[model samples]
Target: MGVKTYDAVIAGGGLIGGAIAWELARAGLRVAIYDRQEPGHEASWASAGIISPAPEHPGMIPLVPLGKASAGLYPRFIAQIEERSGQRTGYRAQGTLQALFAREAREELSTLVALHHGLGLACDPLHVEEAREMEPALSEELQAAALRPNEACVDNRLLTRAVLEAARRSGVEIFAGTGVEAVWQENGRCAGVITSAGKTAAGNTVIAAGCYSAGIGGAGSYAPVRPARGQMLALRSPALQIERVLWSERIYFVPREDGRVAAGATVEYAGFEKKLTPAGILSLLEAAMELAPAARDAEIVETWCGLRPDSPDHLPILGPTDVEGLLMATGHFRSGILLAPVTAQLVREWIVDQRVSLDVERLSPLRFRDAPNPAS
Candidate 1:
């Protein structure tokens, strides 16, 4: 027998790869995903699932457009996934409340409101009473607050599994435990991947292996990605009822439909280590209790850590590379969940139509060619 071939071979089984594979397969292409381990067990499974388009900091401004676009696509995206997989994604559109606790919180909130308005984002400054009315569990120290009504959150663990199932239902073959060691280049063009099991040929190849993308031979230059560890914990409190996702100085709390509140996370540049430290856990607990006093009495349900893919610039490395038939969709860092829908749509457009509706020139993998090797 000869080596198996496909129209597209994605070298990652995480949300990015799975979503892309599903989109391609739905478009009548033979798509396959090779995952080193179980699909969706990494960052996608470990995310808090906040779906806000507002930039967390000024450095993330460039991603706001992409984030907003993805946010807009989420309703249809979730409906399709749920319809195809016969599962619920636990998507919640109750929005988010950002609270300020500093003594000068009112002044700081003014600055925050100005920043959001400058970015053309919807931000409604709220009186502390109004914030408390929305979420009775808010800390008494919350002096100022803002509401981003368009923001949302989802059960990411459920969403990831649902996407994977939807992909399978759409005819995308999944090879769990199949590690792709490198992109196979032939005749100066890309030609699928060389997996640990064997070589697989394909017309086009996409490296979406998250932080491990840099480990794949022949892909380091375009995907100089590294891992950023994030530690998080979950709490259950029958006495505390939060209707919206709550964000404070050092922590954000996401309330699930199952009565679990997810609190996270400390971004540590600890390479590939996924261990949760005592300090990390302690800080998270402190922040969580401070954000919502009732959380102090909540039961600790779970604690976990995940490695987020981080590029040197902390922005996603997307689009085609200089090598023909090769593309990249990794290094999304903290916005992987928020950017998934747009990423899948863009990758599919590039593969099928050879063009994209959105201008992603700055996110191209080739942009790293002139920059210093980040992996070095």
Candidate 2:
């Protein structure tokens, strides 16, 4: 009506931003999303879309509730996206198996199994022979496998596409290939963003630029996000059918619907570097081959890299900053894809109505204000 200052203007049109825009638009708010490239071309595309619950490491038990909430929202979330995009998100409800090759490794796997079971999440313990029989691709290695039935995966690329399409369907404006060079502030509030195209728009703005958040002119000081490059390879195996996701000591193998098994990923701390290293590729291939000998037989087809935007604390930075009407939703680290639903819901609630149903104070940007690194 009044030129629509936009109930929200979001940066980084990947899974998190697109999801938030879709929810906000559905709730009848004017929203706009700015992206350096088209949505889902970054880490969201490279992501395996694993929806595993936070692994129980004693002190991190609180994450279970948050993860379960997001997972609970998945059924409805997937349905909404499919209905909007007219395409499946590859939402494979098949469970994930954390296979252990030795009794020594079982100690840790057993703890995870106990934790998931104690939390009342569906999971099963399978004998080595049984697991191999279920997926003949699995090596006849020793020990056991813990299957987390409640956790599953989605094709992040399709899910991301669905979110973007849903947002457009709901009237949210999308500016792809229009990079927001900086956040412009007026007085004490968010004015909007200035893009490389020399165009300016004013409204409430959000910083969700993933690893590139640190490069944003005015917002960089508040964004201490560093790029951790994860290199992965895809293998096409017509003779193999890896029905479920498999996890091991070094890496994980996720099978796709198109007769390809996705093997990944090398976690490297190369700053702003997205190049793949020979060592990284070899390591992934070795780990994957050990778990599924069929991987060696499969033709290696694709190799690429994506940066997992990490914070000093490894937790996401959410909530508004000291600047009124300007929000921070970037530092999600490795769990970005898995945590998209909750991030979107929480951020949308914060922008539209000024509060979230959950108390995300611990994850607030203000929590890091006084820390050694304010960007943390």
Candidate 3:
């Protein structure tokens, strides 16, 4: 039998890859996704699933526009996927509460509020009592809090599943457990992928392989994505209640629909190794206990880690590459789940219409070509 050809081939099966495949398939193009493990078993499955455009750190503020765009598309995107897959993605728009723990932290609230306000983003400052009243689970030590009503979250694992199912329904052939060993190129363009199962041909090939993207042969030169390890843990707190996502400088807690309070994460420069260290767990538990005293009593349900794909500047390396027919949708860092919908839309527009609606020149894969090596 001759090798099956697809209109587009996706390397990687995480949320980014899966969402892209779903979008392409929905656009009436045959697609194929190659993954070493079952799709979304890595970072997507381990994510706390918080979708806050409000920066977790000062460095992330510049990327808020991208986050906001993606967040806006979530409602319609989730609706479409759920209807097609017959699965609930557990997407919630309840907003997020940024708790101010120290007196000094309270001083920074006005500046943070102003920053968001300057961008015309929705952010409401709350008094300590007001914050406590909104979420009684918060510790009494909280001096102030801010509510970003536009921010939301979802069960990333469930969303990934829905995307995969929707892609299958849209005629995308998903090759789970099939690792793409090399980029099958022809005439100086990306033709397809060579997987363990067999070679699959396509007009366009997408490297959405997350942390492992740089390791793909023939793509290492331009895709300089590296793994930034994040350690996370979940606790089963049936009685401990929190209405929305809660955050402080030290840690953040996300309440699941099923009474599991997901708390994360310790960002480390450790490459690829996803081992849950004792230090990581201790730091998370300490933060959780400090924020909500009742969290100490909550049963420890699971401890795991995820390798977030990070670029040098922490922005995603999206859009087309110098290699013809080769596109990129990786280096999303922690925003993979939050960016899925917009990314899918971006890829669709780029491939079908030959033009991108969103300005992604900053995220172009060629941006890293002149960067100096860290070892030097």
Candidate 4:
């Protein structure tokens, strides 16, 4: 190949950044990704892999297309990776079954149903008995439920491994433990990024550092990304074979291939602190017990905390910034894993065609007009 300075330098080797780097490499760009730790072991690894755009807020209608488009890309993406890497992403289209436990939760179901339907998605409301019949482990007190048949999920950890493999196979260099110190600028335009390792990564750097995107210099106010801590737990339950992804108000359970049930997530604004708390763990356990009694008998195998990259407007920051060459693809909140596929494509288009096919104006990095771009 030509003297490689890397056609694109991706900050952060998480799902979003890794996928983008892989796609860019496939698009004939010599790409490299940097991460402070192991790729996919953060929020992307600490997720339940529920790809449902089902239970999301009705207010997020504008972004539903983006999510659905991403969801569509996943099947082919996972298929390619699984074939190439011989590692299963555990891609499942079994759908998500969300339950209603209280009157308030029942009321919330209507809004979810409407939103899903509006997106041309298939949603079926089921009576309590029907719901329990579908999942006999459900409590008798369950009020209502809904199923979005097209909703799907994947084993996020496996997906991450596949992405890492695909990227490596595509000749993308991954530098773990290389943190970005700052984005270098000269003449008031875009330049390069300086790594904490004392190395300078230049020529089309994409700041996709998840929650830490704000810490990098020249990230500017463009980084509206915030760190929302989510505590998760996994239980080894050979007794509970959940056929589909199950969800209640505060918790959800996604079954993996190894007879382990992945249940999660308490969203707390705990600031960069990834420590798992007893209170959060207790709350999730109680919720799990309520949702699936079999879970109460299962052994708690693991617990962890992940930082969801959130934004001020509760939407992800996508597309180019005011900086000439620097692009942003962060702040996915709880949906980072689900949105990874599309984010990769969107970012690759920006790097290649200098445009994306999706209507990403709503996720503009410059959305906050008063937000100032920083200097290196």
Q: What is candidate 2's lDDT per residue for 226-317, written digit by digit as tens?
A: 88899999898765678888888777888787877888888888877689888999999999888888888889989989998877666777
Q: What is the C-alpha RMSD of each candidate to the true structure, in Å?
A: 1.0, 2.5, 1.6, 2.6
Estimated TM-score for each candidate? 0.98, 0.93, 0.97, 0.93
| lDDT accuracy of residue 202 in candidate 4 | 59
* Maximum-lDDT candidate: 1
Off by over 4 Å in 2: 1-4, 56-62, 118-121, 370-376
Runs in model 3 lying further than 4 Å from the true structure = 372-376
lDDT at 106, model 4: 69
- Which segments of candidate 1 are over 4 A away from where they belong? 370-376
Better of 1 and 3 by lDDT: 1
Better of 3 and 4 by TM-score: 3
- Candidate 4 ranges beyond 4 A from true positions: 1-4, 103-111, 199-201, 372-376
Residues 167-215 of candidate 3: C-alpha lDDT, one tens digit per residue:
8888888888998887888888888888898888998899999988888
